[model samples]
Target chain A: MNPFAQKKIFLEALQALRLKKKPKETATKTDASVCPSCKESFSKNALEKSLFVCPDCGHHFSISAQTRLDMLLDAKSVRFLNRRLQGGNPLNFPSYEAKLAALRSETGIYEAVVTAVGKIGGVKVVVCVLDSRFLMGSMGTAVGEKITRAVEYATHARLPIIIFSASGGARMQEGILSLFQMAKTAAALERHADAGLLYISFLTHPTTGGVTASFASLGDVILAEPRALIGFAGPRVIEQTIRQTLPDGFQRSEYLLEHGFVDAIIPRGEMREAISRLLALHGRTTA
Target chain B: MTTPKPRTAADRVALARNPLRPSVTDYIDHLFTGFFELCGDRRQAEDASILGGLAFYKGTPVTVIGHRKGKTLEENLRMNFGMSSPEGYRKAQRLMRQAEKFKRPIITFIDTPGAYPGIEAEARGQGEAIASCLALMSRLTVPTIAVVTGEGGSGGALALGVADRIFMLENAVFSVLSPEGFATILWKDASRSQEAAEIMRLTAQDLLTLGVIDGIIHEPPNGAHEEPASVYLALDAVLTRELSVLCAQSGDALRKSRYKKLRAIGNRKEAL
Candidate 1:
C-alpha cells in the first residue's frame, strides 16, 4: 500500500485502540466547531470526483500538480522535462533526506516543481507548475535548474513562456545555494526578456520569499491567482522588525494588484481563457 | 611704509587662479556645438532631471541622455533632485527607440539617486515602468553606451543601463540598492550605511573587477565637480571613440553583441 494509505490505517488502528478503553468516557463531550460542510463528510472517492473540494460548501482545497497540468494544458500536450532531477541533503540537516524520501513516496513526485513545454489553448509555451505537496513547493537546485532550462528553451525557440508559481520560498536545506537561484533565474529571465519574448508569470496562493524578488516579478505581464500571497518577506517578519501591526489584507493578490505590483488577479477557473487571450494579443500561436 | 600700500590689480588677478573654476560652460558649448535639448515623455509631462536630445560631438550626430541637477532650490524642485519618475524613464526610452530607428549611436549619462518613490509613482506602476524601459533598451538595434556620471542606483540606473559598453567615472557608485537601504535591510539600522557601502562593493573600480562595468573614466583631482570643463572634454573623447567603434558594426551585429554583453553579466560564481 502507498504510504498515505498505510499511515491512514495506522492512525485508524490507534483510534480503535483508544476506543476499546473508552467505556467510562462514553459521555465525553466533542468540539462543535467542525466545518459545517465537513460535518457530513463523504468518502474520499466521492471527494476525488469533486476535485477534492468540500461536497456541500465547495471550499476548494489544493490540487496536485498532475491534476493542474491536466486541466491547464491541451490534451496530451505536456512533455515533461527533468524527471530524474531530485533534491539532495546538502546541509546534512537531521532527517531532511528521510523526510524528503517519505514525501516522495507519498506524493510520487521527484521534485517540488514540474516543468513542461505544452500547448495552452493551442499556444505553444513553456509552463512550469509548482506542486505545494512536495515540501511546500520550496525552491531548491532542481527547481531552479528546471526553471532556468525552461527559460533557455523558450529563448532558443523564440517562444513565449508561462509559469505558475506556488511556492513557500527557497528551500532551507539547500542553504545559500538556494538563495543563488534567485540570481540565476533572474539572469535567465533577463536573457528571455532581452529576446523580446513574452513571459507571463502566474502567482498562486502563498508565493513568497526569494521567488517573489526574482523572475516572478520580472514578467512582462505579471498575473496573480485570486487571493495569492505575494511578497519578498512575510508580514510577520516585517512587522516584528518594524514593531508595528500590518494593515488589512496585507500582501494579498488583490492588494498587490491594487498597489500596482501585479497586472491583474485572475481566477483559477478562467485562467486558461485569460492566458489564451493574452497569447493571442501577442500574436503567438501553437507549433 | 611704502610697501604697505594696497596691492595692485595684478596681485588680485594672481590670487584668483583657483583651478576649481574654469571655462566649463564655454568648453562644453564648443565641444557639444549644435546641441538640442529634447523634453517630455510624450505620454504625460516632462522631467527636467533627465535631459536628452541631439548633439553634435566633433561633427557627428549623437543622442545624449543624462541626469541634470539644479543649482538652486527652485531649479532643484524642477529637476526633482535628479530622481526621475516614470516620465523621465519613458522619455529616455523614447529617445533610445528613436535613435535605434534612425540608426544613430546613443550615449546616456546616468546620475540618479534612484527612481522617484512616491505614492503617485506607485499608482502609475513604477516597477512596470522600469521593467518596460529595461525591455525596450535591451532589444534596441542601435549601438548604445552608458556612462555613470554619478550615482547609479537600482532600477533607475538599470532602465537606461543596458548597453554594449558601460563606463563609470572614478568616484561614481553603481549598486542594486542604495547603501542606506542595504544597511537598513541587512543590518536593521540605517546608521550602518557606510558599512553597507563598503560591503556592497559599489565603487567603479570594484565593479570593473567584478566585470559589472566595462571601464572607469578617470576624474579630475578632487572630482568632476572640481574641473567640469576638463572632465567634459575627457568624457566627450571617450564617448566619441566608443560610439565610433560601435557604429562600425552592422545593425544585426550590434544587437547580437549587446544581447551577449548583457547575458554575460553575473555569471562568475559556482554553487558553494
Candidate 2:
C-alpha cells in the first residue's frame, strides 16, 4: 500500500478503538442506574437492595463507613469511641485546617477512622472502620491515636478486634506526623496480638498505601470485599514506574488471595456471616 | 558533577541529589571494614534501596544501614532511586533488632528524596513500616548515630533518624517535605520551589540553628564528590569521638540520653 494509504488505515483503526471505548463510559454517565464496571444497568431499587454490588459481575461498590458499621454490627449495638478527638495541623500546612473543617462538616465526622465497641452477631468486639469519603481515608494523628486506643481497649477487654480498612495512604497535609500513625497503629496492633486477642481486618474497595501495609495486613484472618482494589502503589504509578502493562485483575482482592496476601474474598452481603463465623471459630462465644 | 557554592537551600538540594555525590557505599568502604551485607525484611523480598548489614567502624562492631541511590540510570531504576518501600524499612528494622540483640552500635546514612509513593507501597503499609522504625529506634538500647549525607526528605528520613546523635553534611538538606512539594502545596505551583526552600528552613545551617542536627560535617568547597577522602576522614573522626563517648554510658543512660536528645529538639529556642 502507498505510505499515505497506510497512515490513513492506522488512523482509522485508532479512531475505531477510541470510538469503541467511549460508549461504556458515556452509558454509565447517562444512566444513574448503570454501573461503570461490567456496563450492566439495574433499577435504583435493585442496586440499593444488592448493597451496591453488581448482581451480574459481583462488582463491589464503595459504601460509607457508617453503612458498613450498620451492615456488620447488631441492631443498635454500636457505642462510638474517640468521638471527641480532632486532628491538629502540627506542621501548620496551609489550607489543611479549613479542608479538615469542611470535611468534618460534610462527613459529620471529626476524623477518618471511626472506632467503636459493637456487637456483631451478638458477639462483643471492638470495631473500627475507615471512611474513605473523609480525606480519601488518608491516615493522620487522630486516626492513628484512635486506632491504637481501640486496639488497646480491645486488648484490655479481652474482646476480638475487627477493622474495616479503605484508604489512600498517609495524609500529606500532616507531614511526618501523618506517617508516624502508621507505626503507632502497627505497634498497638502488635501489643494487641501479644495479648492473644483475635483481630480480623476487612479490606474494602480501594485499600492502598500505609493502611494496607499496617494493621490491615496484620490481621489474623484477612478478608477482602469482592473486586476491591488493594495494593501499595496505585496501578497507574506502577505502570509508569515499570513502563509495562499490568496483568489482568492486578491488585484486586482475587489477585491478593492468590498471592497469599488475603485469606478470602467475600461479598458484601456475606461479610457479616463470614466475620461472625471467623470470630466464632476463634472461640469467641456468640450468645 | 561540580557543585556550586550552594549558598541557597535549592542549590544545596541540587548538590544533594547530584549524581556524582558520595553515597552510603562510598562511606562504608572508606570508614568501615569487614563489612558483611545482610538482606531481606524476613517477611518479604529484600529491598536494594536500603543497604544494611554488620560492619566494623574502627574495630568496633556496629550495624550499618543507609539508603542507596544508584549511580547509573539503570541502577537507579533497579534501586527505585533510593526511595525505600515498606520492605526497606522492615529490613532496617530487622537489622536494628539484630544490632540490639548483639549489643552493637547503629549507624545510619540518610540520602533519599523520600519513601516510594505507590499504591503497592501504601498497600504494603509504607507508613506503618516507617512508623515502626521510629518507635524501634527511639527505644533501642544501643548507641545510634544518623548521618544526613544528602537529601533527608520527610518521614522516610526521620524513620532512621531517631538516635543519640544526628549529623548532616554541610551541603545536605533535610525537611518535613521536599521543596517542590512545599511549593506545590503552599503556592499551588511547584516551580516556586526556590521560594519555598527559603521559607522552609531546610538547609544544613538552618537545621543547625534550629537544633535539628547535632553538628555539620563541612564538605569540600567542590562538595564531597570532589573530595571523598577528606570527607571520609572528617566523618570517621566524628563517628569515632561520638561512638566512644556514647559507648562509655550505660545502656539505660544511653536510652535516657537519646530520649532526652530527641525530645529536646524543636524545643531549643522555646526553652531559651
Clashes in each model (backbone N, CA, C under 3 Å)?
0, 17
TM-score of each: 0.65, 0.75
* TM accuracy, model 2: 0.75
For B127-148, candidate 1 gives per-residue lDDT tens digits of 4566556656666778888887
Candidate 2 residue-wise lDDT, A28-74, digit = tens: 23335767789988864455445567768878778777767766777
TM-score of chain B of each: 0.86, 0.96
Whole-model lDDT for model 1 versus the true structure? 0.68
lDDT of 1 at A39: 70
CAPRI-style grade of the A/B interface in model 2: incorrect
Where model 2 places Cα greater than 4 Å from the true spot, the runs are: A1-34, A39-45, A284-287, B1-9, B39-48, B72-80, B83-94, B114-145, B153-272
- Each candidate's fnat, listed in order, reads 0.03, 0.18
